[model samples]
Target chain A: MVVTIIGIGLIGGSLALSLKETGLAHHIIGVDRSPDNQRQAVALGLIDEPAQDLTEAVQRADLVVVAVPMDAMLTVLPLVLDAATDRQTVIDVGSTKALLLQAVEHHPQRSRFVAVHPMAGTEYSGPSAALPGLFRDKTLVICDAPRSAPDAVARVEAVFGRLAMRLVYMDATAHDLHTAYISHISHITSFALALTVLEKEKEDEQIFALASGGFESTVRLAKSSPDMWVPIFRQNRENVLDVLDEHIHQLQHLRELLHQENYPAVYQQIQQANLIKKILK
Target chain B: MVVTIIGIGLIGGSLALSLKETGLAHHIIGVDRSPDNQRQAVALGLIDEPAQDLTEAVQRADLVVVAVPMDAMLTVLPLVLDAATDRQTVIDVGSTKALLLQAVEHHPQRSRFVAVHPMAGTEYSGPSAALPGLFRDKTLVICDAPRSAPDAVARVEAVFGRLAMRLVYMDATAHDLHTAYISHISHITSFALALTVLEKEKEDEQIFALASGGFESTVRLAKSSPDMWVPIFRQNRENVLDVLDEHIHQLQHLRELLHQENYPAVYQQIQQANLIKKILK
Candidate 1:
């Protein structure tokens, strides 16, 4: 199938690579607003060619993958749907879903678009960061699948399945909520941790040299692009705020336990936290 | 040289492997409170044999490595020193340094002991978690090194140097304070993040299915053993509390910005956090 992937960056570029590697896409057309991204996407072989016009790209492709940032998705999804034919399937690979799904709810071509959040990515970004098997063994969340035509949903499932992703179905609200707890809040904590350590590093220049693997892993997501995350936090504002509040509360509780010299309580809390191993493993 | 490694868990076991790999120790004696650990250490070839008596082990070895948790270090360091001969060198590899250094400040054999914290570890613990080259290319902080005998310091330095660790010299107070920002705070944040997600998962079983690499890395240290962390936190209580306060403050600040829908400020904060890429890479 001929696939048009918009915004040819980390997720889009990785998707292009995966689709091509799996023989799922006969030819991949890249559609990105930035000239640099379009040039890099093609140079990196993440796409067969760069499309100059979004409408023409949508019209010509068997599959349209809207892989733009959250803010851009609000505008681009509607435009993509407008140009999509009945036979074409449109799927958006975005972090947050509620707002994007809401943006095009009443559209005549809404049935063509399937909202997907493939639970995978690295700290790096841009077309140069693209790698094959980025989605292998990772979860692919298909939000509000019933809203999309059955054939469109099946196509998305098949594509991600071929890419070796585990599929989970949820509504847009639950997708945003769960992502806040699992994905979005991790970025917020990482960004905060980096800021915290960097703030301390100014006073002790030697501290950076002491950053070990544990510190690196905890602060890794701080390297994520603001262009991708700011819009995500904005679109999923309420959910992110709720999870952030709970996260802050948990931290404060730990602080209080430590302040009281209640080592037992602190130990208990950590033991509780270790329960994540059951799920994550 | 003969080496006796007490508390043959992650650090001690790895140290045994490194020492054996470098031929720094011809014979490695394992000492641990747990029979299972002693058996595992020998079974895993982390040590040549298990020592039945601490005094005999210290007397026979050219060097004694105290790799116990923080709580054990208080009693174990003095005991090891009590048994150490003038020809023997001792080193305690624990996370916090100020308290341990203070506990042995007046010992007659104080010069025989060196305080070191190798900034390398995983969330996992125990002898089975031991791996070769765990300390390679990682920073090794030597606290209050001047207090140790010149020959003792040289021996300790040579051992870690052979393991390919970069050594940094600092006083105990500075070591504890800096680790609070660079190491301890990372663990606290990771534990808190894991707790927050697990709490949400109680209500939503499918939430964990969406956890991606980002979430896993950010919460990886949460799986750290409580037996290891509770003691470190107790010893470095004040410094950990200070850094934890600042970390929580930063989280709250980000929460406020997101709550107010200040995407520009959020963007700026993330951009600032991205400066870590410079230090981390």
Candidate 2:
């Protein structure tokens, strides 16, 4: 099948590489709003050809994969749906699925669309950061899959299977809530950690020299791009806020334990926290 | 020099291996309360011999290194001072400096003590987790060097240098505050993050399989020992609380941005957070 990946950057470019490398797609074409991204994606062999002309690209495509920033997905998705043929499948790999899912809820060709969120990425961004096996051994969350045509759902699942990703089907609302706890809050914490240290600590050299593996591990997501993240935070607002409140409460509990010099209580909490080893691979 | 390390585990056992392998110490002796740790340290060749008695271990030693859980340091350090001769020096490699420093401040042999915090180690612990050159190229924070005897400080610095550590000098209070920001809070965040995800998500296998590098990096410290971490938190209570407050406040700000659908504001905050690249090596 011919797969046209729109907004080919880290996620889209990676998807393009995986589909082509796994022989899951016959031809991979790129559709990016940035002229530079289109040029770069092609230069880096992320796509067979740059689909600078979306209308022409959509005309021949059998599958349309939207891998753009969450905010931009709203604008571009409707246009793609309007132009999609009967056989053409539309899917989105946005972090926030509920907003995008709601936007296309009543669309005429909504049955052709499958909302997906592949839980994989690196701190790096742009077309040059694309890696062929990026999706391998990751989870591909398909939200509201029942809304899409059986053929379209199967097509997306098959593509993910080819890349060695495990598929989990859930509603858009459930997907958003799970991600807010497991993924979204992590990025916020990392960004806030970076800001907290930067605002208080004047000596850059000291932070660099003294940042242990623990600090690096916790704050590593601070390196992620603002363009990709801002929309995700805005789109998944309520869930993110709820999780953030819980996290702050946990920190406050730890602080109270410290203030009281309650060593036994603090140790018990850490031992409980160590239960994370069960969930962590 | 003959070096004796008490409570041989991750930090102490690793130091023994570095000393023996580098030929920095003629004979390394280990004294641990646990028979398992004692046997493992000797079997792993971390020490030349394992001493059953702490008093005997220190009396014959030229230099005694106490590497134990933070709670036990206060108890172990005083005994070392009482047992050591004028020719011998003692040092404790504990995460918290203020408490340990204060406990030894009034001792007649106070000048013989050197307070060191080596910012190193993996999440794993115990003698088997010991690795050669674990402290190499890592920062070693020496607290209140002026209070230590010149020769004692020189001997400790030379030992650290032989193991390829870069030494930095700071007072006890400053060391605790800076470490709270860089190290202690990271553990608290990781522990809470693990708890947060565990409470909300039910699929254990899915969480393990789908834990990407982002999740691994964010929750790495959850694997640390509660026995080792609890005391550090208690010792550095005020400083840890201060940093924790700032971190929670930062998360609240991000939540507000998301709540308002302030995409631009969210983007700008993350962009500023990306400045952590400047501080992280």
Candidate 3:
């Protein structure tokens, strides 16, 4: 099938590569707002070629993907839906779902839109970071599946299955809330952690030198693109805030234990956290 | 030269395996307070044999490594020091340094004791998790080397160098403080993060399925042994508390952004946090 992916950055470019590599898409077209990314995506062969126009890309495509930043997804989805035919399927690979889902909830071609978030990324972004097996063995969350037509949902599922991704289904609101806790807050913590060390310690050489496995893992996500995350945090504000509050409260609890020199309490806190082992594996 | 690892858990066992594989030591011996670990160390061949006594191991050894829990190191070091000769070298792979260094500060064999903290580990511990190259390309922190005899420092550096690990030097106090920020606080945050999610999230299946890469990375250190971390936090209480306070402050700042729904402020906080990009790479 012909697949057209918008944005043509990390997610969009990688998705195009994965689909073509898995033989799920016969032809891949890229639509990016940045002329530079559009040129780079084509130069890198991430797509067959950059689309001449969005409307033209939508009109000829069997599948259209909205992979723009979370903030831009709302603005782009409606316009894409306006150009889509009944047979054409539109999907968004945005990190936040509720906002984008709401933006297209009442569109006449709402059935054409399938909201999917593949929980896959790296510290790097852009066409340079795109890889052929980026989504393999990762969880792909499909939100508000019922809202989309059966054919569209089935087609997306079949495509993701061929890419060897495990699929989970949830509503848009639940997806946003869960991701805020599980995904969005991590980026914020990592960025803040990097900043904290950067600000408190004047030794930049020390951080680079002494960053052990723990610090490297904790601060790895801080290297992500701010342009991508700023809109994600904006789109999922309430849920992100709730999770952030809980996270801060947890830190405060530990802080109090340290202040009191309560070794036993602190040990218990760590033991309790150790339960994440079951979930992670 | 003969090398003896005093505790055959994560750090010690991995070190033994790497030393053996690289032919860094002619004979490798194991010593552990836990009988199970001793037996496992022998079974896994992490060492040539299990030592019934640390002093017995030290007397025959050219290099003796005390890789016990941080708190135990203070009590154990003096006993090991009493048995070591000027020709023999001692090193402790403890997370905190100030206490370990202070405990042996005035020992007659102070020159024999090298305060080394290898900044590498995993959530799981035990001989089974030991790998041949666990320390390859990892950082090893050596503290208060000037107090150590030139030969002792040279011996420790040679071993770490042979393992292809990067060596960094810092004072005992600075090592503890920097570790509290880079390593210890990450564990506390990770543990607290796990506890917070567990308290709020009840469905085991949902948590298992929905816990994304971000949550896993943020909470990974929670699975570290409480026995190991409790002592590190206690030994480095002041530094741990200091970093914990700063981490809480950063969290609160983000919370305020959320509470105000001040999108611009929240965006700015995240953007500021994103500056960690420069330091990490």
DockQ for all candidate structures vs. native = 0.91, 0.65, 0.69
- Candidate 2 lDDT by residue in tens digits, B127-147: 998988799988998989999
lDDT string for model 1 (A1-281, tens) is: 99999889899999999899889999999999999999999889999999889899999999999888889999989999999999899998999988888899999999998989899999888999998889999999999988899999988888889888999999999999999998999999999999998898888897776888998899889999999999999998999999999999999999999999999999999999999899777
- Per-residue lDDT, model 1, residue A63, is 93
Q: Which wins on lDDT, candidate 1 or candidate 2?
A: 1
Worst 10 residues of 1 chain B by lDDT: B200-209
Stretch of 10 with least lDDT, candidate 2 chain A: A201-210
lDDT of 1 by residue, B116-176 (tens): 9999999999999998999999999998888999999999889899899999999889888
lDDT of 3 by residue, B1-281 (tens): 89888878888899998888888887998888888988889898888978887778899999998888888888888999999998789999889888778888889999999999888888888888887788998899999899999989999999899999999999988888888778887887778778877776775346456676677788788889989888988999998888888888887777776677677776676667677666666
**lDDT scores for all predictions?**
0.92, 0.86, 0.84
Give per-residue CA lDDT, model 3, range A1-281, as digits (tens).
Answer: 99998888888889999888878889988888888888898899999978768899998899998888888888999999999999799988989888788788889999998999998888788888898888889999999898999999999999999889999999888888788768887887887787678767775457457777788788888778777887888788888888888888888888888889898998888888887777788
Candidate 2 on A1-281: residue-level lDDT in tens? 89999988889999888888878788888988888988898889888888677777886898899888998999899888988877899998898888898898899999999998898998889999898888888898888888999999998888788889989888888778778877888898899989888877775445455788788889989999988887787788888888888887787787788778888888888888888887776
**Order of all candidates by lDDT, from best down to worst?**
1, 2, 3
> What TM-score would every model get versus the actual structure?
0.99, 0.93, 0.97
Each predicted model: what fraction of the native A–B Cα contacts (within 8 Å) does it retain? 0.93, 0.74, 0.67
Q: Please say which candidate is ahead in TM-score: 2 or 3.
A: 3
